[model samples]
Target: MKKTRKLIYLLEDNDDIREIIAFLLTEQNYDVCAYPTVKSFNEDIVLGKPDMFVLDVMLTDGNGIDVCDSLKSNQKTHHIPILMMSANTQMFTVKEKCDAEDFISKPFDIDDFVKRIHHYMD
Candidate 1:
């Protein structure tokens, strides 16, 4: 018997952070498709959606909150869960503005990160 891995779309500007996140998720049996820019992610979203989305709160090109709000408002991708990753201490303010499922402040414990991810898993 085998398990079907969940596909994750990760958007982060820092290459090292993205790689580390991808590695951790992959180690946990997730299929991660990471993008450095929101532009690339937006382009790929049209091709297909992912099981989950992990977005950086601050992007070089755009704000992740706007991205999450757009996706939540859309008809097609509204059901997918989105997790916002940020180092911002004012995450509650940002979370209140958008319709993200949850948020994780950066320098977060790996155990807590995994636990939060599972909390939203279907």
Candidate 2:
């Protein structure tokens, strides 16, 4: 049987960031579904769960940490690895509080971003 490629669910409010990350992940052979908010993400979960999640720390609707907490707390989705990104490195405390699998600061190196995605996807 052929193995299925892992899917990555990305939640980022920035259009440029979303496009760039999506392009990068696609090149790396992962299927990506990008969303701009928790509401849309929640809606998509009903369709199917991704192998992992890439979440932004801030959104127009609310804090991404809160969304991460919700995903982690839920039995159905808790197993999915979550990689969070933030522009504010100072929010390391908040990132820790969320208990994400990993955290990447914004303006991050492309190589580092790809490495983190591969790390979690693996």
Candidate 3:
């Protein structure tokens, strides 16, 4: 039997960036669900859990670190791998606090982004 494709949940406020990233991941044969805010993401959580989560550091509603923290703390979702992206140079401090599985600074190379995702998936 064929294996089911893994799903990736992406929480990004920027539409252009989100589309580009989604396109990249889709090209790589991963299913992606993109959300512009935590509120939207929360609504989808009940529908299904993705194999991994890609979160941005900042959002119009609040910081993504809090979202990551909540997911990591939740018994059902804690084991899901998180890949966090941030434009802030201070993101390392927040990353340390959140204990995310992986982090990427914004204005990042697409190759590096894909590589990191592949690394974590492995």
Compare the candidates by TM-score and give the number of the best one: 3
For each candidate, the alpha-carbon lDDT, in order, equals 0.90, 0.90, 0.90
lDDT of 2 at 68: 91
Clashes counted in candidate 3 amount to 0
Q: Give each model's clash number.
A: 0, 0, 0
Model 2, residue 47: what's the lDDT?
88
Candidate 2 lDDT over residue span 1-122, tens digit each: 98899999999999999999999999999999999888898889878879998999889888889989999998888999999899989766866679799998999999999998998888
Candidate 2 residues lying further than 4 Å off, grouped into runs, are none
Q: How close is candidate 1 to the true structure, as a TM-score?
A: 0.94
Order candidates by TM-score, high to low: 3, 2, 1
Q: In candidate 3, what are the lDDT values of residues 1-122, reduced to their tens digit?
A: 99777899999999999999999999988999999988999999879879999999989887789999999999999999999999987766977879789888998999999998888676
Span of 10 residues, lowest total lDDT, candidate 2: 90-99
Write the number of the candidate with greater TM-score, choosing between 1 and 3.
Answer: 3
RMSD of 3: 1.0
lDDT of 2: 0.90
- Which residue pairs in candidate 1 have backbone atoms (N, alpha carbon, C) closer than 3 angstroms, thus clashing? none
Error of 3 at 57 (Å): 0.7
| Candidate 2: pairs in clash | none
